[model samples]
Target: MAGTVRKKMSRFNSMISLDEVSRIVKAYSWKKLSTVEVETATSVGMIAANTVVATKDFPPNPRSLVDGYAIRSAETEGSSPADPSRFKIVGKSEAGKGFYSAVSGGESVEIYTGGILPEGLDAVVMAENATVSGDTITVSSSVKAWENVASRGEDLSAGTVLVSSGNIIKPWHLPALTDGGIDRLTVFSPMRVAVLNTGDELFPDAPDHIENSGMSSMMALLPWRFSNTLWIGQVHDDPDDIARAVKESSDRWDLAIITGGSSLGRKDEVPEAMGIAGAIEVFGGMRTKPGRTTSLYSLDGKPVLSLSGFPSTSILMADLIVEILLEAITGVSGYRIRERLPISSDITTGSGYTRLIPGTLVEMNGRTMVAPASSNRGMRLGSLLNSSGIIIVPEWVEGYHSGDLVEFRLW
Candidate 1:
């Protein structure tokens, strides 16, 4: 409802370009979703709602990274195995304990890994490099300042951002957050999404292949990609039922995706039903192959996507366009890894439309290459399992030659 436009256009002739769709979506005033505070270690798969900064240095004090003797680097500057430097062992430092006395030029402190260094000490000579006998240590090689010693704030300084807003929380993030003294994090609550399949041929037990493909794919992907809680339902090819389902979904869900009945076919009632549901049209269609009928709308301040009935078309549209909308609304980013890689073979696309070809990442002569998948062209269910990524061909560029670098996204 908030980002809706009241304009009308011929679905087939006046389809908007993909660039225009992106511009419009970017211009929309999408507010971030609600947030909840969760323990940092348990927040994986959730989107961070705020930036988490370090409260204190990761290493609160200078500490030893190895079991070694803490000594001044200058004391062993010219020492070698032929004429070794000597130091009198004064005290010992273990984890959670620090040697109180400072080490002078000829003195050293026995220190274990993670032990706080003695005062005035700036380096550690690893145990293997030193031989000790009754309070006397002989260093075989020279030691540099800060060698084997972790300095204060070496890993993370206070005020350093541990995690940024709009980034998905990952497993590796937990240690960083904890090291930064962040025990809890504010993350966006999981968005609730609904997939409404509309086709007269659909049934609960057995459904049309195309319709089931779109529904099942969305069902599996929503949780894995955006972490959205999903609901699946179906309606017959009637304008009233479609309108009712659309309205209900808008009232109860964050986003609703209606597959099938989006094209300008005799049985396609979604366009007319959207009007009945008081949905404001964002765009009637997009200038893209296979998903040219993909449309977007806003109802009650919520996003509603209308995708093609074809399997590959609907799935691709959901993956590309719906993800953008979700990011706009949720402030989450970087769900897929993008790469610029060489193509395994030559490929061509239509002149006026941006083409998305499902592809496989292959190793040709030990280098990863992108090759267009054969099943994707026919929009078969096998395409889903076979393709590992999508190769994007710009609308202006007609084709690419073998070995040409192109952009793609791993699914």
Candidate 2:
């Protein structure tokens, strides 16, 4: 499958970069599709529309923070635990219930936790702390006004940025929306994407056995991070078959990715198949190491990235290029590469390529260190399984050793 397309093509661009590939693949960039109305409670795990606001102040009313007796400040004066003060409880208040009467100097209102503060009452004394006799609750000690009252809008105001645009909704956010008095919101609707893998040999690796087919995981991770994803399965290495697949699949999806057959191969028909479907081949290579086979093109503005078949190459390409397209298409930015530091080590860089060395990051003395996962590319999973992240060795830099300061990416 190597060099078949390049060998036959009349011309191929001599220079290509990862940035160019990203721009091409992200052509249409997050075309908004139809949105469905969802209940605020059920909308958990969905996206947020513009900023959200509290329709009414959270708690909406001043409520008691504890089960206690509500009373006026002047009435509780000259009270102590030993010489307790007694008062007449005019009425009782429970959660969701409110007392409306204004209290006189010697009277008190019975208030429970979450109960609305009675009218003209300023403070509350705990039920256990006060002694109740007849309709009166004794004041065990002097109380201050507003001491046990939850003020209106204390949790949230009528208007606030509950959530902003471009945020992937989490389950906890739903309660905020509910508290904010939002029944429904205009969230960035889920992005539907098609994962079109092309190759006779590009089979999904055995669950127990891993392969460079990591592209599938890499591709799937994009939608997982942003919106909806559909695995369209693999197409035989036939131009007509591929073209037909692209046209048919494009109807149901917002973005389409054709992996595996992007490069030069006797059976590599993806580029031509895309061309046959009237799609533009933006570029077909990158300057990055472990991913020279990375390519990008688009059909009717939808994104399509071609990743190398090697696991290391596909994973790196997906994290960098495919992830970029996902962000562009869904208006979502994927997680950044995090770092930890371990031991410091240096590597020799070959003259031509920009190398991405697999490494573990560990933090020591508040500084991060980068240790090589391995010099070998095929055993990436070994490093990935226990990795901190890649220790990026620039194009021209030679390497480093122990005690050398290196950047880290946390896993």
Candidate 3:
């Protein structure tokens, strides 16, 4: 009955599976990185270049790892609490100072934290474990050679791959890169993308109109949002208007995104408009719920991702589709929001359509469960204000009882 109803509607193009669409994007993906020398301080959240070799060997010299008595391992080999090992402290080694004297048979050096290790002294006893007299320190514990000693080049080599390419520089990775003398790096330029909100009823700021225009607000968060998301604004249902916007924007954008008109099930004008333009490739019309109306095409050899106008469908589809395409192009996989949870309540869903529900994941009885929030599709824009992610359930499942594990991604 459902298939019959779907067939009755005009199927302009055959629906393709998610993997098939992914393959098409993979084939069309291209990486043209922009070269810009960014300060190490400013490039904290960007991808790394090929690799950055260490400018100099880390540590550069043997250093003390603790504040204790630095002594030759042989001198402390037979030391014990009953027969404490006594060594004459000839000199003190503070941080940045090199101990020039060599520790002989019963000699030791007083080394502070980070101080240069004295010659011939391979181990150090912690200050708490050793007793210091007027001119000698007694360590009762035995230690092997090189204990608590940081050898030169132990942390980083002179020429090593600090951070490789395709890595999104995180806060933690920055310190290592900067401290390793990688103050400059080559990062892939941001993807050039433009937003084309289709349909005549869609308004950029109108409360009701904007809400109806699918996942429009997510743009402000895109990596290229502030600089490259040419909000090219809205295009009417007219074929000419949509075609012109696609052509004009295609020049400035490596990829153009049109929200709302790709769905031919409704009175959608996007597919028709793209046909009238120079050239395009449509790989949507999938047998999926919420996002089935989504499609992607390449206008004039430039890629464009088309999405349904519904906010729920748009948001969910954007997370999946954009990451898939961009990863192939730039190797950036964005963020993943994970809060392990089960179905809050039993769900009775029919077979043959992939399902994605905007859910409120909560902890109940020491287990997280997802509860469906709304099914309005495009009607509930405010519904996402508190939402985290969509629980994607495959189309083949009969239903899921409360307490089934499902993972979600952040918007």
Best by lDDT: 1
Instruction: Report the lDDT tens digits of candidate 1 across residue range 147-190.
Output: 99999999899999988988998888888899899999898877
Q: Is 2 or 3 the stronger prediction by lDDT? A: 3
Backbone clash total, candidate 2: 20
- Model 3, span 168-231: residue lDDT tens: 7778777677757778777766667777777666755544554444434546536641125667
Model 2 residue runs over 4 Å out of place are 1-30, 74-91, 126-143, 202-226, 238-240, 263-269, 333-375, 387-411
TM-score, prediction 1? 0.90
lDDT of 3 at 71: 85
Instruction: Give the candidate number with the greatest TM-score.
Output: 1
- Candidate 3 lDDT score at position 109: 84
TM-score result, candidate 2? 0.76
The sequence of per-residue lDDT tens digits that candidate 2 reaches over residues 1-411 is 335555634223553654455565556444455566667766655555556677878888888899988888777677888777888888888886677877787888888998988777878888888887788677767788788888888878888777676566677778787888988877656667677766666545534433436545755655342467787767666778778887878877776766676554455566678778887766766666776666666677666666655565566666666556645654553245544344465466664555666776556668756667766544365556676566655555566667765556443
lDDT for model 3:
0.71
In model 3, what is the error at residue 141, expressed in angstroms? Answer: 1.0
How should the candidates be ordered by TM-score, best one leading? 1, 3, 2
